[model samples]
Target chain A: MRIVVDLNRCQGYAQCVPLAPEVLKLNGEEALTYNPNPDDAQRLRVLRAAAACPVQAIIVDQLDLKK
Target chain B: MSSPTNGNALKDKGRIVIVGASLTGLRAAEALRKEGFSGHLTIIGDEPHEPYDRPPLSKQVLKGWVPADHTKLPRMLEVHAEWRLGVAATGLDRAKKVVRLADGDEVPFDRVLLATGVRARQWPNPAQAALEGVYTLRTSNDAARLQAALAAGPRRVLIIGAGFIGSEVASVCRELGLQVTVAERASAPLAGALGEVIGAIAAEMQRDAGVDLRIGVSITALEGDASGHVRRARLSDGSTLEVDVVLASLGSIRNIEWLEGAGLAAGFWGVGCDAGCRAFDIHGIVTDHIFVAGDIARSPHVLFEYQFLSMEHWDNAVLGAEVAAHNMVCEEIERRAHLLVPAFWSAQFGVNIKSVGVPSFGDEIVFTQGSRKERRFVAAYGRRGRIVGAVTCNNGKWLEYYGAQIARSGPFPPHPAGFDLPGDMRVVPAEFPARGVPTAAPDVVLTGHDPSERHAEFRPRAR
Candidate 1:
């Protein structure tokens, strides 16, 4: 699965960090870094992280594939 | 082993009814489908609109950056459930396992989820609240009305109670270059959520952003003009201000009235539930069919000394709903506990304030990193030599680090000092107001023991 984060909407809430620590990481105070592609085994964790974002900034490509 | 056909027959068949069609209800509906629950699902809500995002109602929606109607939450999955909008669940008949609606309809269910949530507390005076310009920012309708009022360019906006919602509105008014006066009864802003030490900094932030911050005073009365529009506000300090718009940001009241005679352990605090989100009877006996989540569920946390905590935040609603939904369909062996560490975030005065865990649970605080003078710092809350919570101002990237410490019950005055440590790390009292003191910011409530119960009952199951 591939991940995408809307940098413009990401206000650095960092809610997605702990949920998917292996997939997403925070660089500094407000800068966020994440892996665009993650193993399929991490689908559940990635989906949770995406859903937990307050701003709905995170997007997963798996949903698109299902479409 | 059972054949695949037999397993499929047992997969899903029962009917599930979910109360409260807001964030929690909507998410749980989708999650139930994701959990392979092919049962008949029914979602009931009082609001006419479908599930929509609420955090933006106070920020982006009020600012007109996004319209109120456009805040509808994106459906992550197709939830083929019956939608009963604009009608409220009047009562829950647990004996019959059905939910009574206001429209004289009864929906039977094998399982039920109560996520009624809370509503904003309006002005005490009904007559004043009916005035044209008096507003309370809770629903999308409230935000749309207040946004139009702000767009109309009122001469002055008189905001009562400097809570997070009130403070956010004050910030928006200043950004629009309108005169806004915030009158708070506490000495500092947000003293109810974060202690006075950080609240003092918030008071300065409001003042620095061109808000007429008034502390230690309350709006005694709101006066309306001949046209029945709010025209002036009388303060407790024997002063009056001419204002066109008045917002009563007086916290919220849990939507537990509908569950009054349901025999559930629900009251002024909220519905009492166990760690697994199963509702308890008035006698404190855990029930099997009924469940609760979101802001209305008050379950005890093991990390916080088993005190029932009621958290009203965006994250809590989403997390709690997922937990409730999971337990509603899965077997006992597959069930999980809802032990999510309480967290919340707010954006006001150009500063992003985020907290991990319940800061109100701590008795003392110590600054670990950054500078408070710069309005960028991280403070850790300690209780009995353990880290219970942490709040960061514009330094949310470090939240996960502190949140880990809080989850493990780390020692107070955290070590492994980062490179950006503050010069002085003096431990001081958090200085929270005495319990039962009414404040606008009622973020978290840790209720220990039942306050209303007079007697207890015990029963033993046959071996």
Candidate 2:
């Protein structure tokens, strides 16, 4: 699984931080930091955090079977 | 008649129509598509633009950090639906299962989601409100106009109310190096939402930021120039300020007027709904086909003594929309609750305030961490011995912890951990305004509490 957050679109609402702590975290300055790819176990939460984003800055792209 | 969507011709997935194509409506459409519900979908919106994020309209957009039009919410999901933009839903025809649009067109639906949301409350005097410099912040266009006015360097800006939006606008004005005066009728800023105790701390923040904060006073009238632009404002305290810009942050009015004769339990408190987001009829019976979401929804919370909860916060709108969407296509047993642990965040006066749950639901509050003197602390609000709400200033990481406590229904005045507790951790009355105040409380109110509603099962709490 791959997760991507658009730095330009991110408004720092921090709604994503608490939902998937292991996959995403807000630094001391409240700027978003995250693991772009993670194990499948955290897949549901990552997608949820992406959807919960008010700005929809988080984009979780599924891997291509061909790739 | 509109042509049927291609997928609908092959299979019967049913037709779903959504009104109010903003955040909630857009999110709900995404959820429906994600849930594998391929159906005929139609989204009706009164605004010309597509869905957009509103939180930044007061913060970054106003501060010139982001363009007002650039804040449109990204459409992450592939929703193949017909779009009806820039047209209002004038009425609902439930028996015929159709929506009446302003253009005299009726869109049939197997089910519909009412996410009409709310609009900013207009200033009482319509004539004065029509003045060129007078404004209210609720839409992208409103922010754009307000931002342009600020860019012109107004000598002074008069903010009429001290609600969340009002306070944030003042913060932006300060950031722009502009002089701003805040006139709040309550005892303190944010007195209605956060109560007087926390409002005091907010008041100090506004004052320290060089704002002319006026409490316990009301605007008598606004005086405009002959050019039809606002020039000055008169106050009840016998004071007049020559201000170029006037912002009325008085509050919001739910956009449920069209649902009047449609037989849904809708009124000033918004539309009443069940836990699963199913709308209740005018006679108090849950309707399977009609659902409600976003700020216009006032569904009961099981944890908060079954009190109906309505919030204009971003979190609730997204979560509620998803829940309503899920319930629309699923069986009764598969439905879920929109029981989001209501959370919100606001950055103003260099202080980041975050909170979870309904703080206004509590009768008493106590600061569990940090100190008020330092303007950084965590306060817990409790009622009937259970922690109902909490607020944190510059300490949002702890929001999840208190949210759990609120969900657990922990004891109030939480027992001091045997050590490191502040010496003067005293409890105080929340001091919310009396029940009758128009804008003091959130849009949440018991449908039964209203005298006219005969079928509601709620009694107004003694204030």
> Which model scores highest in TM-score?
1
Candidate 1 per-residue lDDT over residues B1-463, each given as its tens digit: 5421232322467788999999899889888888898978999999999887787678767776657775666566888999999999999998888999999999998889999999999898999899999999989999999999999999999999988999989988987899999999988889989989999999999999999999999898999989999999999999999999999999999998788678778876889999999999877889987899999999999999999999897777787989988888776788889998988877788787888989999999999989899878999999999999998888877777888999999999877456699988999999887776444432323344776745443221221
TM per candidate comes to 0.85, 0.84
Interface root-mean-square deviation of model 2 in angstroms is 8.0
- lDDT values for all models: 0.84, 0.82
Residue pairs of candidate 1 with colliding backbone atoms = none
Off by over 4 Å in 1: A1-67, B1-11, B437-463
Residue range B180-207, candidate 2, lDDT tens digits:
9999988999888888999999999999
Q: How large is the i-RMS for each model, in angstroms?
A: 8.3, 8.0
TM-score of chain A of each: 0.89, 0.86
